[model samples]
Target: MAKNKHSGKIVQNSRLLVGLVLLVLSIPYSAEARQKPNILWINCDDLGKELSSYGNQQVHTPVIDRLAREGQVFTNAYANAPVCSSSRSSQILGLYPTRLPILNHRNMSPVALPDSVPTIMQLFREAGYFCSNGAAGDLAKPGKEDYNFVAEDLFDGTDWRQRQEGQPFFAQVQIHEPHRTFVHDELHPIDPAEISLPALYPDHPLIRADWARYLESVQRADRWVGEILDRLEEDGELESTIVILYGDHGRPHLRDKQWLYEGGLAVPLIIRYPNSLNAGKVDHRLISLVDISASTLGLAGLPIPIDWDGKDIIGGAKNSYIYGFRQRCGDAVDDIRSISDGEYKLIWNRMPEQPYMQLSSYKKLQYPAYTLYRDLDQKGELSAPFSAFMATTKPDYELYHLKVDPYEIENLADNPAYQGELLRLKEQLERQLQAVETYPQEESEALIQQAKSSSRKYYQEAMQRRNLGPDPTDAEILDYWNHELLLNQKPKTKK
Candidate 1:
């Protein structure tokens, strides 16, 4: 009987040991179930909210639409600026476009972000998350290279997929399709007659054909996004990843890109965070692309850097206002500033030297059909279908009631009825500008020096040429100096 009791106790201890083993195993699964999500930011170039999912019945974007269905859709999302570099800089840095001196669209020179300023990558890396970026086109070099993964191929996201095993990762995938220089024959096999022209464009056949080609390019970008999503699924990483798909800026056509109108600034933002987010929720709060940096940091379980000017959007705060500015696109130098509160938009043009409706770019000048629309607009022939996108210079103040006229066709600045609302937006714009404008000129100058120092090796070689260059003619000396400068500078890597 004692021998039988001993065997029974052994069995009981064995059962206890199995339970303990199960509990220990369950800990990791439970931890992993609550683990911080891996972030995948898919930033597309030159896409607007023209998808059927975003209330436009014109374009089809199945992958982006799927993301919207699976997560939250932000209809009132605005880029910090209407151009790629400025808007994208704001997205990663959480600073306004003007805060960076490179906000001037005409100044296309490299503007390296200071190393002292903390980026989302810096914050995530500190928090034990690996960061990788597959930036597209010219978006990968200069100030952005320090934070993003610089690679040869533009279409691949493999670098982002192979991060550390247990640690979370922040991967940014940028697509450069749909920007200008779209091929007509290859991209747009569809008939131009079938294309619906935005009222801002003259009903010219060439204009419609150009617009169709642009649409085709946008469709191609959607296909690339679908491929990325498929890759995530294949890697079994989709469920654990928080995917956000958005546009860097509006298109580079009429009423887009260089303007401060809805077509220029407003973009589609779809967040698919099944791990921590409730799906199918549509958020219409006026959130800027700058908020993207804050939201990214917040979701990564990192504190929003204090120097960041963007607001943390996960707290259900109703963002009432977002600002926008336009300097120079190509060669047009216009100082246009604007602010929007989802319901109303007010614009202030500091340089009232020219008419508000103008195009300074080479292509637009070359295409007489493109100028026809602007000429018609100046004559008030075409309804303000795309007035918000007009680059033409106007008087100091302009106002539009977005609730009544969402297209911003009618300017109410001269009307007495909206004096109160106009004044309110103006004050709010000034207040927000002042709040984030603390980046001192001296600080920026210091940052510029740091940026210059990054290319010191090239500068040293250029100085050698400068010392040897004492040509008889002034132009020859200048040419030699320029050649030296060019030789020393690092070239942008292959796409």
Candidate 2:
């Protein structure tokens, strides 16, 4: 009887041991089951809310429109900066460009992101998500992430398919479209006559033609979107992946690409997830691109860093205003800061003595409409709205009631009726500047000198490459500058 009891005890001990082994074996699978969803971020360059979904009849973006129909569309999404480098820097680092050394677009000497500020991808990587930055073509060139401190460390590769099985991923795919030098597509030709001119733009044949070309580029961008979606579906990751589609900044036009106006600051933001949270909804809350970093980390179930300047837009409190910063862009050196509360927009031109239209070689070469407008202004043929771009010097402060003046035509800074609103916004701007730790605008004489030196060097290099003589005529120099600008297809180059 004692032997039988001992055997029974041994059998019970063996059963317990087996149960413990089974639990240990199932641990990894359980963790995998609780893993965060994959993220697919698609960023387009030089695009705004020109989609049919945005109530614009001019451009047909069927793929993006369908995404909007099945996703959440942000009606008031603004880029932190008007141009690419500054905006991209802010988006990646979750900090304002003004606070970083990359305050200007295409900074001559690219500023590295501080070691303390980890990129969104880096956060994902630390959270066990495989991160990849497959942004190529004009969008992933050298200067694109030159402002990023350790850009290479942020991503594993340009592709994420090679990631470990059952592992989540964070992928960024950047597309270049609707930018200048619009590629003419015969199959998707837009009618110049049908193109509607904005109030600020002249209704000329050349301007219409340019608009039509831009529409065609938008169509091309739509096709690229379809291709990316198809790839995601092919991988069987479409439903489970959190997809985000947005533009880096507004359209690439005069007073649009580098200016602080709506044409430059406003962008389209659409997000889709399988959980159906706010799906097919339109969020009118003011959102800045900088908010994306924290929001993305929140989506991945990761802890947002305390030093980030942006709030988690997905779950955090709503923002009352979105801010914009503009410093030196290409060869132009200026200081402009703006704040918008979705209804009113105020611009503080720190360098009020500087002309609104600074002589930027890149702008002069790329925008033919700029040349046309300048010629028209010279001839005294420009009207009120069109003539605004030709102002010798901008006002110290400019205020616009977006509801009444959607195009931001009239400035109400000095008006007695709007003084209260202006002062309120001004105070808000001050508070924002302080919160972001932005310093007062300093003179950029050094930056201007650097830009001129770089421009001369680039010209000389191009001429030498072409085997042209060293002595170039005045006309020849101008032609060379234009040609060099065209050859450098990337928007906002850091020379």
Candidate 3:
């Protein structure tokens, strides 16, 4: 296990002129793979490092834990963007969304990938390897393709079994478990009291119970992982295939998923290579999620695109910095950029005047905890740090020393003692920002209001179904979601 020590230092890199891949590898670059391994990408939705392998004992993910034991577990991996569509769109082409200028989530209009960059699926099919993207466990079912850009004919079929005999397969299996509206696992129940609430959340049973339910979704996803591996074993391909399991971004929580915080941008990455290569090793290399694409092309013995943003992570130099972005997620409109160099992180909130929860209809509908947070803050039950989240306005810049302040509750940006460090990273990140073409940040307010109006329809319907009184408190909202949705019981009769 590689240790990440806080040097309280910054290394200025002048070569951030391309993709959001400044965190380049320091190890010698090598792409020697004579035997092309069948790649299996198990991409789960809105999942973070909740598995036992990552040291969260509450969620019993034996299969994923076993994979961690038999594979290389990455400790420092961040998504290029917080939202799924933006991350998915840039990842396949081995570039960043801002560099490709496809930062919109659920974009009504999408541009095709640059003619220079060919998707890995197209290349794999051209190389005679079968490509499939389907649900986890049952590959016959069509999987989620929430790409922000226009991608066509990306898959050969829904399942690898349809491929010609002896043909290698590159399967992109998307697991939907653990996203939202978590399914309770009856067989392995977790105690609500056993959960640990983050500082951003109030220490309440409702919050813990909500967390336990999310763990149930994690358990369900884990069981399906076992089923996927079992099928590979039964088909006599387990030993020959290279399985790469990762989350699209982070957990589906109140402040996660759509934000640029660590809870939203961070994800779990595990690579199980055939013949037990690099098995049982825990690598703490600073890496971005897009590196998987470049690594994929290298693993397939194909020539990587010259303009591909990500580099081969298998054997690369130490990362200087990794960048992330948040822009136009769902009905919410915001522009936030982040740059981290393993120890220190800097977040630039372009629209700092706006409140954190500014008409994000998805959060209002899907997360009962969202209501609870606002209610608690309104009641003055929430203290410093966490209460700051509910503030009407945010600081233009936020900085955290991740090694010392892993939870990111402290704001070192305004502290006079850290002025030198703050300005250094700020100027450094600004230069990095200039390199990428993030045009969507300049989108009009009219376009945003139109999209918000469209998404509000679904939120209104869900709220109507619950039928909480117009002035219902957060307690009533939480209780409604808990009993009505999770327990499969109707909401309490509104009197």
Tell me the TM-score of each prediction against the true structure. 0.73, 0.85, 0.89
Worst 10 residues of 2 by lDDT: 1-10
Model 3 stretches astray by more than 4 angstroms? 1-35, 467-476, 482-488, 493-495
Number of the top-ranking candidate, with TM-score as the measure: 3
Candidate 3 residue-wise lDDT, 27-91, digit = tens: 11212121457889999898888889998887889999999989999999889888888888777
Candidates 1 and 2, the one with greater lDDT: 2
Residue 476 of model 1: what lDDT?
A: 36
**lDDT per residue (tens digit) for residues 329-374 in model 1:** 5445567778988888998887777664443433342233445555
Model 3 accuracy (lDDT, Cα): 0.78
Best by lDDT: 3
For each candidate, what is the lDDT? 0.64, 0.75, 0.78
Listed per candidate, the RMSD to the true structure in angstroms reads: 14.8, 11.8, 8.1
Ranking by TM-score: 3, 2, 1
Determine which window of 10 residues in candidate 1 has minimal summed lDDT.
Answer: 1-10
